[model samples]
Target: MTDELRTTMERVGERFNLGEYEIDAYLAVLEHGELTASEIAAETDIPQPRVYDTVRSLSDRGLVELRESRPMKIVAVDPGDAFGDIRSSLAEMVDELEARYTAPARDTEAVSLVKSRSTILRYLEEIVADAEYELALSLTPDLLRRFRDSLEERVAAGVSVELLVTPASRAPSPEEFDYESVATEARARRGITTPVIAVADGEYSIYATQDALRDDRDRYGVIFNRSALGFLVSGFYGTVLWTTAETLATDGESRPFPRTYASIRRAVKDVHELSGEFHVEVRGRDVATGNEIHLEGPVLAHEFDASEQVASFSVAGEDGDPVSVGGLVAALEDVEAQEIVLDRS
Candidate 1:
């Protein structure tokens, strides 16, 4: 903090920070080019007694010039000249402030609630940009469009993105939108009941109602980062909102194995569409023992519930018996998979 810099900042602060009367008087004189104290009081709401003090304050700030003629005129100084020093000082001050700034640690919290719309939007963008492999999102049409460019970039970088836009009626038709550029697959759900969600690489996620993204007083979004609890959000998206969505577009582009998944339902869906024997490596926890388990073998069978919300696969275990694997909090299966990797047998 040099003395000169400190003085310049103080001068700038004094110059632009104005009271109501001073602002009114300054603008009145600027608008009329020049005006007497009587004219200024008549043109603005500043009372006659306070008009002299207001104009004098403006003059001291170098915003206006005072003429020593009869009636004492107040003249507006060209704003370009008046504000040049202030602008320069502001730029310098901002540089100094930025130098001292420490970014808030985003990964320190496991779960957080955010209320501001801008903050929610920022988190949405951050999650989208941060995804390295798989990304799943449930968004409104406007939010889809807002982040389409970033999504497209991720797709181009070989990141698989599955997008769900709701309510289905408001989503763009295949003819009007190029879904392939932004998503590996894109779908539309029939109602606004689908919450706005973004999951990045299965670990970081955000969830909020459609109302939370809108301009309303009561709104909130939840953020999950580096937490085991994040799987709950991804599971809900895959089994709940995603299964009910009607496919709007799919590239049908086959990605080479080994592919990884955070959602078992998605992994099962892809395996169901395959032709022959495929191998899988499951990183998960035993349902009964609550202990970590890793299983790798040729996939024997895959199952889906009537609604297709629940999905699991059977693989030969250590004793040559089939083990059933489900996603997230898997109570009905032998193991709850946190990540599933697939490849050729």
Candidate 2:
């Protein structure tokens, strides 16, 4: 046989092998068009005793046809004809398996340890997609790119996204990153030693050691789902990590209103930075009747917890009436705020 023909046969053998013996027996019949069990054993290295068993296996898989002649001849079914049914069967089986498959119930589990880098990445993507109101993430440059699409989707859906990337030099530039497309704000930390961290809606969080990205085989991460442990992760993120990071880009116009008193304090600080009068609107349900309430006016005064989870502020309404409001941070989940418009009039 020509080297080209041998190479082609070798490729085909590897691509569609049933087993070593089955491939040897099938290829022997293909070479001769048809071969009796003894002829196959003579042409291929398969033992005489094993050739018949190997041929029988190929026949069972519909890869070869068997004729019940005196020696039980094996016929090479055309590769096209042989694999077409196998391909169809595989496709149908995949569809059926997909239909029956249910995603694991991981959301309710308090804690999970994920060891595969790919699985950790998948969970990160899922956490971002599942967020409704808030997201906080610290990522390496590589992960930032991997999750860019998922982040953009959630931001477009009105989920607030705060992103921090480490080793500022490795991060994409603001122009290249297009921060407005994916995040409410993006910041950069000074060093590469930071762990990869993410919190979704301030409830679900993932914390991974830096090695998680260095070696896929050595990777590990922990997921906290609505567990009190999540609070520790978020606190470290907010107080230690986020506070020390330098801003890279921000979409002030698209920033969602502060939903918690803690977020309110952050908003107030931003207003304070402006050193000017600003119009503010606060929307929430009245604790008594659960009736929706809207308070809009120029900022008067504000008070909040050091943790920013509880707050009260006074606002002057359009009617020249002073209104005072106070509530837990959890109460602000239903609230929405427009960009603070400066009332220079």
Candidate 3:
């Protein structure tokens, strides 16, 4: 009832892991002691069924006790103690789930596409919680409209949802919409800040997007959850699209990236892989010293900071895979190179 008491309960509730609903129940019962289940529900605006459970929870932990008679009335115990017990129980459950997921698996490969509703939810939930630094999302409007509530709940619980909704996606009548403002209320203090987005999350990344113009309703979603490989791909290409939004200066061209943010969406058949021509430098003594082999045309760019008279060359390869030592020697020899000087510093 008093400011001092509310702040105390909030800190206590945090310790015990009480959500807003639980906190409301505690405070309302504190003000009006000895109330029936229905009365508490009405006063607190919690569902009648949930109110009974909540009160029962309080009673179990000595926060509330039922008067030992007919038409049983409930009394508030030392609100803090009752709420603390609730916190400990919840914490144990989360600890269990974390342990369950952290165990090593035989299938070390990352998941490509997840389709089932329950599994998809679990996947998203894992991605949301597993995010150590940031979580990026390019949500189809339809998908967001469907699971909007579930997504908002994550935001409420201290998960920073840096969302990416396309220009074409429209809100659901403005009333069913508004993830930012409501989330700000419950999560702002807990570190859930929004309107921040990038497909890359430092070590691991996922590219989730849909073409609204071609398909208004997204049939399925894709998730790339690999760590090392995903990071390499994200480093090269993810920022290009993310840059379209983040780098836009007020006076500068609104679209900072050369093409629309969807440029990669068109070219990228497998959105998980980074496909492009990336420069690679070679270094070794005697350019023609290595075994002569067929050269990959136009793909390699040779840079000799100091030319043992080193020459430029191109090679064909994926970003994540490492270059073979022998392959480089042969490629150099195929170009009929002389005096190879490796750029290795």
TM-score of each: 0.78, 0.56, 0.33
Model 1 off-target regions past 4 Å? 1-86
Q: What is the C-alpha RMSD of each candidate to the true structure, in Å?
A: 4.4, 11.1, 15.4
Stretches of model 3 off by over 4 angstroms after superposition:
1-27, 31-63, 68-73, 83-101, 104-107, 114-204, 209-221, 225-345
- Taking all chains together, the TM-score of candidate 1 against the true structure is 0.78
Across 33-53, the per-residue lDDT of candidate 1 in tens digits comes to 999999998999988999989
What is the per-residue lDDT of model 2 for residues 63-164, given as tens digits with 9 covering 90 to 100?
789999897888988988977755665665556657768888887678899887777888788888878767889999988888889999988877778899
lDDT score of residue 23 within candidate 2:
75
lDDT of the candidates, in the order given: 0.89, 0.71, 0.42
Predicted structure with the largest lDDT when compared to the true one? 1
Which candidate number maximizes TM-score? 1
lDDT of 1 at 188: 97
lDDT of 2: 0.71
